[model samples]
Target: MWVNLGVILLQFLSGSIMYSYIIARILKVDLSKIRDGNPGASNLWRAVGWKYGILALFLDYLKGALPLAIFVSLGIVKDNFVISLAALSGVLGHAFSPILRFKGGKAVAVSFGAWSVLTKWEAPMLLGTIFTIFTIIKPKGTTVQEDAFRVILGYLFLLPYIIYKSFHGDFHLLIFYDGNFAVILYKHYKDLWGYLRGQS
Candidate 1:
């Protein structure tokens, strides 16, 4: 139990670093003043160029992936619940970073990292495929708002698969799923609310 708690705490702190935000600041780009006001790779791409954007994206992704990968693979955290919490910690860290004054990015990239390490890359692929389809379909309702809705929708779709695999009745996966979904929904709530209002 103590080990799990430690892993959870470490993962949360790890997730909270906000590497992309740091990268943007180092480049003298104020993400808040940019389009969509997102302190993430997307805005970095717009403010700088693809090289920096991709670099920021990779670092943001690594923060989540590397830690969980080390902890899980090394058998440092074997409990299913701990594993789930540890994975979600990375996502939550990026979503609610303390260093960023608790105002963090939406955590799309970090979510991929968490899922990638947690499910041995399965969940990430599923989520990525959904993202690809959404990209191809080119959904409407403004870019950020539409993307937020897509994320919420994509996770809803991913739930069934997680359920399908977790038929053992262990709720670890569900815990991570629910928590991650809540963060994503919460982070994008503004855009989501605007989208809903517009539709109405």
Candidate 2:
């Protein structure tokens, strides 16, 4: 039990470290003042170019994936529920980072990283496929409102699998899924609301 908490705490700390913000700062680009004030990888692309943006993206994803990978690989944490907790902790950390005064990114990249490792890449592949399909229909360069809507919609589409797993008695997956979905919805609620009001 204590070991599980330790791993979960470590994952949260790892996820809380904002690589994108750090990279942007290193390049003297204040992300909070530019491109929706997001301090995320996409804004990095606009401010510092694609190379740094990609780098920050990779690092953000890696921060979530790598620590969990090491724990799983080294046999430090083995229980499915514990792993689920740790995975959700990672995404939660990014969504509500203490390092950033409990404010953080939208938790997209970190969520992908954590879920990719937790489900052996199944979750990420499913989400990527859904997101790609949605992106094709909607396309980028539209607005952040659309992007936020698409993200939540993509996660909503994953709910059936999580429910299916729970029905099959794999409850840990459901726990992680619920926690992740909640964090994402909370983080993007403003944009989601904006999208809805604009459409209405």
Candidate 3:
């Protein structure tokens, strides 16, 4: 039990690396001074171009995927829990990275990576569906409002899965679906408000 607790704590700490922010600082860019004040891939692309943006995205994904990979390699936890904890930690780190004063990205890629590893079939299928939708109806402008709407709509679409998994007694499923989904929704609380106001 203590070992499990320690692993969880380590996972959270590792997840909070804020790869994008760190890279921005290393490149001598003050992300807070930029438009939208977000240190994510899209903003990085605008500020630095595709190369740095892609690098930051990859590192952010790695920060989540690698730790779980380590957990499995070390036989630190059972398969189910390790995958669950890893996905949670990775996304949590990306969303509320302590290193960046709790300012971070939308937890999309990191969550996708961890989910893909943890639940090979379901995770990919779900994420692919989201990708397809976004591809078809890509948002025009690059604003926090647009990004937030994308996240809120995406999670609303997936809410049914969370309900189904809960009834099926698949708590590990919840670990992947509910915990991460809820985090994304809560993170975009302001966006939700803006969206509702516009509709009214």
Candidate 4:
């Protein structure tokens, strides 16, 4: 139990590093004053440039991937509950990083990395395909918020597919995916609400 706790704490710390914020600081760009006021790679791209943005994205992905990979490789927490907890800690930390005063990225990239490890890339590939199709269909000049909403909608569409695939077994995986979807929706509640209200 203590080992599980330590693993979770370590994963959270890794996620809380706020790679975008660090990159923005080094580039002398205040992410808070940038697009959507998000201290994330997307905002960093808008604030500074794509180079820094890509770097931040990679770092965020690593934060999620590395710790979980290490824990699994070390056989620290073999049970599904503890393993899921470790994965969730990274995402929660990224979404609500302590270094950024408990405000952080949307966890899109970080979640991708973590889920890739957990699901052996099946989930990410499916989601990425959906996201790509949506991106292609999105009207030009769409606002960032709108694009994000479209992505979430895509994920919503994925739920049925996930359920269909797991009909034979793996009920725990359904719960895991649902929990992730819930976290994402909750994190983007403000944006989603504003979009619904036609308030930019």
Q: What RMSD does each model have against the real structure? A: 2.2, 1.6, 2.8, 2.0
| Candidate 2 colliding pairs | none
The models' CA-based lDDT, in order, is: 0.82, 0.85, 0.71, 0.79
Write the residue-wise lDDT of candidate 3 on 95-157 in tens digits. Answer: 888877787677776766676666555755765687567756765553566667766666666
Q: For residues 79-117, write the lDDT of model 4, one tens digit per residue.
A: 766767777788888988999888778888888877766
**Candidate 2 stretches greater than 4 Å from native:** none
Best by lDDT: 2
Q: TM-score of the candidate numbered 4? A: 0.89
lDDT of 2 at 153: 85
Task: Provide TM-scores for the models.
Answer: 0.91, 0.94, 0.82, 0.89
User: lDDT ranking from best to worst?
Assistant: 2, 1, 4, 3
Judged by lDDT relative to the true structure, which candidate is superior, 2 or 4? 2
Error of 2 at 126 (Å): 1.5
* Model 1 TM-score relative to the real fold: 0.91
Off by over 4 Å in 4: 139-141, 164-169, 198-200
Instruction: Kindly list the per-residue Cα lDDT of model 1 for residues 77-114, writing each as its tens digit.
Output: 78887788788888888887888887889999888888
Candidate 2 per-residue C-alpha lDDT over 144-191 given as tens digits, one digit per residue, 9 for 90 to 100: 888788889889888888788789888899989888888899988898
Reference-based TM-score, model 2: 0.94
Cα error of candidate 4 at position 28, Å? 1.0
* Clashes per candidate (backbone, < 3 Å): 3, 0, 0, 0
Off by over 4 Å in 1: 139-142
